[model samples]
Target: MDDFDMLGAPQGSAGNGIGADEDPAAAFLAQQESEIAGIENDEGFSILDSGEVPSSLIQDPDDANSRKQEVEWKEKAKLELEEWHTRQNEQLEKTKVNNRAAEEAMVSELDENSPGTEWERVARLCDFNPKSSKQAKDVSRMRSVLISLKQAPLVR
Candidate 1:
């Protein structure tokens, strides 16, 4: 009435029930009033409650400093992304060079005419991974294979 006390009363109160002991119609009316009051109180909810502008919206309107900081953050992010891409490209190029040299050396090892390059024979004699770089164990096995192949007499 005078205040929105009854109008804003919570739902399911003395007015919102069809129970034999309670009044369903009063309950529904009270619920509707409460909802209407809530809508009116909510900022910018409807054009019905005059110009009761909300205070929160007026408090921190997007100021110049906020906009400037936002732009600065975006620029910083963009530069960081560019630097990341550049570093990624450099690493990729380095890997390509390393792989190319490794492939060439592997091919040479496979070629029979290439002297002292016996990776293919070593790979065949020992169940070793072809991609394993020139490690001590593989080299040791390769020397043994070379020695055995050289010393073994022709048994045709």
Candidate 2:
């Protein structure tokens, strides 16, 4: 028999030789065969029929949750960094206050001939020199002021 004969409709009434009211098994097989033929003719069958599960099916493909978590973590980290910087600034301010107090104490110990003379000495030690003769005059004037203040009578 021809190849078509094997797949031909049941033998009695139709143009294709298959009859109406065919056996359920035969009908099922024919339906399956037709589906196979349709797939063979379709160009996209290979792509559509790939056996692998799509990534979208396995997990939530949208990154909304992950992105939100990242933003939250960044905000938390930023807050922590800001707090650390604030603490560092406070410590720097405290150090500045202490340094100022020490400088005042050292200046007070100098002889009355020059009040800020010790500051000038410190500046010289650090390799900086007064810019002009006027600066030296200012220093002497400041010294006189400090001496006069020291000599003033104390009041309760």
Per-model lDDT? 0.69, 0.68
Question: Per model, how many backbone clashes are there?
Answer: 4, 3
Model 2 per-residue lDDT tens digits across residues 111-148: 44564355444433442234456534446555555455
Per-model TM-score versus the true fold = 0.47, 0.34
The per-prediction CA RMSD against the true structure, in angstroms, equals: 13.2, 24.3
- Candidate 1 achieves a global lDDT of 0.69
Candidate 1 lDDT tens digits, 1-156:
534566564544344444445666888999999999988788554433566556665566667689999999999999999999999999999999999999998887566666543544654566435566765444656656655765563354
Residue pairs whose backbone atoms clash in candidate 1: 15-26, 15-27, 16-27, 17-24
- The C-alpha stretches of model 1 lying farther than 4 A from their native spots are 1-33, 41-61, 113-155
Candidate 2 lDDT for residue 26: 84
How does candidate 1 fare on TM-score?
A: 0.47
- Top TM-score model: 1
